[model samples]
Target: MQFTDEDLGAWVARQRWYAGKSHVPRFRILDVQPAPGATRYLLMDDAGAVPALYNVPLALVDAPSEGDAVVSRTADGYLIDAARHAAFAVGMLAEMGVDVGRVTGSRVLSGEQSNTSIVFEEDGHPTIILKLFRTLHHGENPDVTVQRALSDAGSPYVPRFLGSLDAEWPDSGRESGVARGTLGFAQDFLPGVKDGWAVALDAAGERRDFTDAARDLGTALAGVHAALGASLGTVDAGPEQVASTGLTWRRRLATAAAEVPAVADRLSAIDAVYQAALERPWPQLQRIHGDLHLGQVLAVQDGGWRVVDFEGEPLRPMPERAIPDLPPRD
Candidate 1:
């Protein structure tokens, strides 16, 4: 089955994970890779101010059932979102070479931003969360690299890395059949754990003292930083690196000022703060979670915390995300 650019653009615009939601995207198919039970398309969007890339994996079925995950109806069959289909989800796990024993069930997790996550459950084996990378990059993703490194370093703060999926493709304007991209990642899932954000909110509502938990969380984060630095190694922030970072800050501020009317009023003050910060001696830049917050963590029953989602800011470019930089912005 095949789809036109217009059809894909319309479907992409309706998806919650799509970055360019305000305008209709002009699509260009970079490559197509066949998965176990689906077809993955590497696409480039030229609609926004900057061109962006994405991965759209689709499953073709002869007919739609009552609970079918159909995205569109084609002449030959119904197009389904593979990430949301149980069979496709299981196939993905097999592709990743994950030995989950006997897979009993699978379901798509909600509240994901840039990628689709499917949770596979089995009786004996540990539950697994398979994250399908929506945005396609040329090489290794920091999420996969960082987690594997930390897990190999014996870090208990992160989930155990199971396996991954990648594809070779022929990219235009480049050497044919040399380009490869990360398709998805699989990791152990901690069941019965609550998100840090929810835990914090509940504690606040109950007027419970969370100072100790906060302190422990801080300690764990520090340990994670130490592990990442030890494994990946770090470099001193040279003058050129500092200058480039400063420029990024300024560009981000300018973009915010244009998009948010309220920011325009304090642009001068923001610029002043940025300049002042730039003048100070920069800290050694190393691999860290590029996007960190309460929500990116989980609280276990034993008063322990597990950090998840090493994928950097979804809107940032892949190359920039892979490079070591300042600590997570939030």
Candidate 2:
């Protein structure tokens, strides 16, 4: 079934991709196109105070495609197809005369939660990974923002950002409005290496050692820290922030304890780690990985780990999700 403006608005509100829930947001169709028998649309809105965009590409596949077609079921919620939702994205970009040649092949990257991403090769030179941002926050995204800064600083570890495609606001050129809303990003697709998380999981699942993987990740984390510091200098970690970190940990632990009950007994053990972190003889301020996990690193063909997706955890607020953050605060 196709979505009318009202239907699309309600449908977007119900989506896990919607991102904002506190207010009944407004949506404007910036562009539209026919996709064979399907309908492609680009939508923009102030999701509460968060300015966001969506490229809603839905196929009228004889009835309606199940919710699972566009969203992947996850432990938290459905993961949106930020990457492969291209029909509408193409329509949106068409306004700017963005040329989309024939598609070669498209594959969804694994280990995604909120956003959807798909990699496509164009004549086999400079493959592009299109990322649709899941959560919308006003202002430029820190992932794109920081990565661009790092790229400008000549860092080669992160993929070279090519450009972004999004919908332009109709009233943007007017005295008081936004010019465009970001829809997706096109970046150089790194080839070959399996994601660090998959490698680690394989090793663990096969009863093999993960020491090498862990060590490599540790080293990559260090390099990422250094590069980030070079790009965005260190800052002081205030006592208030430090105390707040401890309290946040406590609250997280408390919530988990409430859910699992037995975890309450291990609070002391967790506290030991926290206290050690606080007492460690290290710089309290440095630009470090805001969200470092096994999956965020990749083992390259050269055997060194390449850090991927500097976009911090989606669960965190936008302000705290970027690098140049107080190292200890992370």
68 Cα displacement, candidate 1 (Å): 2.6
Per-residue error for 87 in candidate 1, Å, reads: 3.5
Candidate number with greatest TM-score: 1
Clashes of each: 0, 2
Candidate with top lDDT is 1
lDDT of each: 0.83, 0.61
- Estimated TM-score for each candidate: 0.89, 0.67
Candidate 2 per-residue lDDT, tens place, 1-330, comes to 223566566667776666667777788776664542345566777656656656576543222223335432334333333234445444433332435675454555665656777676566543666676655444456667666666667665677776665444345645666444455565667778788778877888999988876776666566666777777777666766566666777878888988886898887898889888766544546555567666677777777776767667666776666534555443
Model 1 clash pairs are none
Question: Model 1: runs farther than 4 Å from truth?
Answer: 1-3, 124-126, 175-178, 257-276, 328-330
All-Cα superposition RMSD per candidate: 2.6, 7.5
Can you tell me which runs of candidate 2 are displaced by over 4 Å? 1-6, 9-112, 124-126, 165-182, 205-209, 268-282, 323-330
Residues 207-276 of candidate 1: C-alpha lDDT, one tens digit per residue = 9999988988888888899899899998898989888988999888889999999999999999899889
